[model samples]
Target: MREIIAETNRLQLCVPTMDDLDGLSALWSDAETMRYIGSGVPWTREQVQERIERAIGFCADKGMTFWTVVEESTDTIIGQGGLVPISFNGDEIELGYRLGKDHWGKGYATEIARASAAYGFDALNLDRLVAVCYEQNLPSRAVLKKVGFRKLGQSDVYYGVHALLHECLPYDLVR
Candidate 1:
């Protein structure tokens, strides 16, 4: 059974499982949700399956991965967010979150983000966490900045879009 890693008044972050495939597919397959994420193209069902498999494997191997964020009141999966181990630029972890269109502007991202960062720093003992987004993705950039991320500079043009990297130490946000 997957453990519940974090919970807020309205959301719960838990490990992704096969049971989440449908919710995740609906969330990931929407073009609007896919915008600014790697490629702007929406993910196919097959790709969503593969992603679920990969997320499960990543959790087993790394003890960390993007988790399913569910709305507690409705028992509906509104999104996914968490800390992911990465090797980009160096050995480090990155924070990421994506929510369904219906859930946008609800502050769920920031709520789950705070819990994820606390888990990464206080529980996992990570030194820092990083986040990257397309330069034009103002909403995401704003969320990262609001969470205390400082712009490190531009990153490689990925998926035909210029990206920016931001980083924050656990203390930067937690304290």
Candidate 2:
């Protein structure tokens, strides 16, 4: 097991491992869960394996990577999320998350996102964090807004689509 990264009342965030592939694949393969993500394509097992390899490498190199978000009480993995380094206009820390359909509307997204943002600011010492999502992803936009990310009036071509850009500072985080 990897070190625990964050915890909410009902969830725990920890470094992702190969063992997470089954749960992670199920989450990523769901069309509704991946609708706004890359290519809007449900990931295959091979793709998930590649992602796991990349995540492991990312953890090794950066000491931080996407975490497997799990329900503590049920010991079930409901999602994966984290702060990742990305090029939003040079180097920047980007907060990202994805949850299974069954986990939607449970406030788990907000809970994990808030925790992930805290780790970026408090643990990683990042002064600013950013996020990008499909313009139509209202739920994700709402989560970003709730976390104090402001719409930057900028758009970036990502995942073969234009995504709205958002930014937040350490002070902007909702404590």
Best by lDDT: 2
How does each model score on lDDT?
0.85, 0.86
Write candidate 1's Cα lDDT for 1-175 as tens digits: 5468888889999999989989888888899889878868898888988987988898898888999898989989888899887754567788999999999998888887888888888888898898889888898888887888899999773335578988999678843
Per-residue error (Å), model 1, residue 16: 0.7
Residue runs of model 2 more than 4 Å from their true location after superposition: 87-89
| Cand. 2 TM to true fold | 0.94
Off by over 4 Å in 1: 157-161
For residues 59-115, write the lDDT of model 2, one tens digit per residue: 788867778899998999898888878744567878899999998999988998899
Model 1, CA-based lDDT = 0.85
Worst 10 residues of 1 by lDDT: 154-163
Cα displacement (Å) at residue 140, model 1: 0.8
Which pairs of residues collide in candidate 2?
Answer: none
RMSD of each candidate relative to the true structure: 1.8, 1.4
- Per-structure clash totals for the candidates: 0, 0
